[model samples]
Target: MNRKELFEKKPRIKINDKVSYCPTSAAMELIGGKWKSVILTHLIEDKKRYNELRKEIPGITERTLSLQLKQLETDGLVIRKVFTKKPPLKVEYSLTDFGQTLTPILTSIIEWGLRAAETKGEFLLDE
Candidate 1:
């Protein structure tokens, strides 16, 4: 089927009552996009500028990265700082304290992914 038809055919989840979005769902809504996790992972290190992030994450479009960064900022997971300088100005991104709380969770996921990759021989295929 064509893209539109395929999407139209898919079933959508709906809540019958006036239920509010749960914390878990809200969290997912913030970070569940394609680039948020990678962005957060990079921010776990030292603060980085926009260009630095683009270089590190291959295949991400500038527009997508910008949108993800904005979302993270809105969620209070990332702080964006702009410097007023002559010649060339710079923008930097860093994790807020709320965002830092995600470090252990992301680290655990990374560790589990590493173990799973080893067991499944996934790394060998990448070589």
Candidate 2:
């Protein structure tokens, strides 16, 4: 490609050339969907089977859960394992080491949500 064409296709702005628009945007891009963070938080606690995750996270359609899990696996945040040695096949999901890096952030988010819920009268802090 010619220099002019290349420059036109991608500007010289290093920041914009990056995958994310900004630092916060990068974080959001990874886990900003309706249930991405929720799923990640659950995985943080322990590895869970697909059905277990579905039961833990209310109102998430099976399709959405499957799609989200695929996306998470693609993003290297979660690992999916399949076991086929038994009569019924089994699958499980868990966070990878890279995904574990988000624990502090997810914990903070959970704490913030709890406090917000208390203020909104949806939960009691004392309880």
Candidate 3:
């Protein structure tokens, strides 16, 4: 790429008080984590209850899930809703408009995973 193109492609910017020379770093700050992206992948489909998220993500522990959810919420990427006013409370999680912006990135990641599983790695069945 030419110097002018490089300059156009990567302009320094700041978000959430962090300065990033490259935009990818900014994106990673918000979504780069072991479980953050996975949780987001599920949320891309639709809103899910807390238990539902826990169930869908097999290896994630309850505490970890809770923590990740809180972080995502704090980052303005996820929203939580409580429906029930009494016992057997109902809560659901969904992507915010900002979170929805990640749909394409997440989709690309999903596609890459599938391709790698087929071409380079093997998918194993759960015991």
Against the true structure, what is every candidate's RMSD?
10.3, 6.9, 3.3
Task: Please list the residue runs of candidate 1 whose C-alpha ends up more than 4 Å from where it truly belongs after superposition.
Answer: 1-23, 124-127
TM-score of candidate 1 versus the correct structure, residues matched by position: 0.76
Q: Give me the displacement of residue 124 in model 1, in angstroms.
A: 5.4
TM-score of each: 0.76, 0.80, 0.85
lDDT of 3: 0.93
Instruction: Compute the lDDT of residue 76 as modeled in candidate 1.
Output: 90
Q: Residue-wise lDDT of candidate 3 within 39-73, one digit each (tens)?
A: 99999999999999988999999999999999999
lDDT over C-alpha atoms for residue 62 of model 1:
97
Worst 10 residues of 1 by lDDT: 11-20
lDDT of each: 0.83, 0.86, 0.93
Better of 1 and 3 by lDDT: 3
TM-score between model 2 and native: 0.80
Candidate 2 residue-wise lDDT, 57-122, digit = tens? 989999999999998888889999999998699999999998999999999999999888888859
Residue 67 of model 3 has an lDDT of 96
